[model samples]
Target chain A: MEAIKDKKNLQVVINAGWCKSCGICIDLCPKGALGRDNRDKAVWQYPDKCIRCGLCELRCPDLAITLQEAEEEE
Target chain B: MPVKRYLRQRFFPQLWCAGCGHGQIMASLIRAIEELGLQKNNVVVVSGIGCSSRMPGYLDFHTLHTLHGRALAFATGVKMGRPELNVIVPMGDGDASAIGGNHLIHAARRNINITAIVMNNNIYGMTGGQSSPTTPVAAKSTTAPLGNIDPAFDLVELAKGAGASFVARSTTYHSKEMQNMFVKAINHKGFSFVEVLTQCPTYYGRKNEGVSPTEMMKKFATTTTSIGSPKKKENPELIERGVFVDQERTEYASSYCEMINQMRKQK
Candidate 1:
């Protein structure tokens, strides 16, 4: 049951190659779950804080990000 | 339990396609409502037919899903009947500036106490991608197979000319800015209009030159410059976007109510 909850945890995947770093996703994130990666690319700095708002995924200029709620491992 | 509960239409998943900007706009609206600390009972969300019109159903409030292009008309009635309620009309480009154009103009003209949030995805998303009055000239659509020839209506200018008490424009990509605008609109005492330039990834994507919703959002973010100056009149492209206008003037309902009260006192 714990594994399932962990699996279902929300995660944001960022493809740095496609990221434009416009900061739109960063600004719009209601929970402040995102921040810049090592290369100044947008990343999910704190995945646990994600509310799965999808603003980052939706506003990513380069289609570089995807958001998924991890499924629980039963 | 929290004082505010979710009252929007749950049956309808985010109606717009994946990556569509409408979702962001909807989220911004909900956030704005929460930020304002409004009681759900005192707020009513009304909508007309179109993608954006589906908004009222999803919000947990007194919702009215009315006829196409007539949201403002119905909202006016709601506001008049219950002057204390915060009435909000969320509509699409076609529903607001096209089929419902007349109502939109008159509502602003009347300065009715309602917040009109026009989600402008440019083309009509529902009922196929038809060219709307706000579709940029030469932009392709399902109906406009070879690019639209008609000039688009500048809603900000139109609202200003029509005498709206508060008028502003922001794109869905600008979530924080758009949220701030919504907050202002709700707080304003009179007719407040906000045109949110959104993205229709499915229909509008294949039709227009833009590819994805993200690209469209980036275009909106880059192409439009701030209305603030350095006041150098750059090329027309630079002047296309941003908060073009904001003004505080007489609100219709308050003034009208005052007049009626004075007359009653005199009698």
Candidate 2:
């Protein structure tokens, strides 16, 4: 459940277990920030390219993708 | 709590087909329930027989998977028996409009406190892709190989005509809007009917345009417009999406209680 932290202080987490690789999120991502992993699961491939619009999180049919604010480091 | 907590964890990687719109609807529904901050134990998810009816099984709320087209009937009983509980019924197109149409209208007429979501995927995906009541004219299905000649039922109009206190329409492609509509529908005091246009890529898509799930979803975005939008005026063919009716009315359960109290007072 560890989230992938990008430079913009946002966490893009994709639950691999539930992802069916439907490609909806990948196809709908306006910035092409999402890409398929070796297992064909969606991954935050280009973290820098994400605009934090949350479209991927909103339209993910599988409920596998999530965007959250990165926790502040002590 | 996270949205995942509202779901039955053991049911992860749900049985729905990949890219099926039911998952999206389920996700939106869970999000709506979470946003409303409703107690999970106090909510009930009732469903009838169909691919869409399987939603209750994955949700963590008190759920009842009932007989075909009888979800509304069972939901009525549940609401009457436990007036305080929030009853939400998710039904398939055929389940709500065909087999259960009577229950649906009666529930609406009674103005019962319940939220009914009609997942209108057009074709019945579960029973080998047969044409349902909402299947459009000239649409191809297993039961309509030469293209269906039957006209589709206008669910929103039907619910409005049945006197539902709240009525709305949203497609799976409009998940954000759908979630908001779900919130409003649940909060509505009387019977609320929300018809969600979903896609059955396996059956409807293959038999018709042979499009993928993503394409079907994209089509939804293009074909639907907000209620009273100028786009609809220009192109009458576009499906209108949004709340068509939202009026306050005396809820059935409360009225029944008041009647019982009045009789007791006379005694």
Off by over 4 Å in 1: A1-74, B1-9, B229-232, B239-244
Give the range of the ten consecutive residues with the poorest summed lDDT in model 2 chain B.
Answer: B1-10
- Model 2, which residues run further than 4 Å from truth? A1-7, A71-74
lDDT against the true structure, each candidate: 0.77, 0.92
- The CAPRI quality class of candidate 1 comes to incorrect
| Residue-wise C-alpha lDDT for candidate 1, range A1-74, written one tens digit per residue | 77657544756877675455656677668898889877777788877777676667645534456666545678
**Interface RMSD to the true structure, each candidate:** 9.1, 1.5
CAPRI-style class, candidate 2: medium
Residue B258, model 2: Cα distance from true site in angstroms: 0.6
TM-score of chain A of each: 0.74, 0.83
Give all candidate RMSDs, comma-separated: 7.9, 2.9
Give lDDT: candidate 1, residue B136: 87
Best by DockQ: 2
lDDT over C-alpha atoms for residue B107 of model 2: 97
- Tell me the TM-score of each prediction against the true structure: 0.77, 0.95
lDDT of 2 by residue, B136-228 (tens): 999989999998999899999999999999999999989889999999999999999999999888888889978778899999999999988
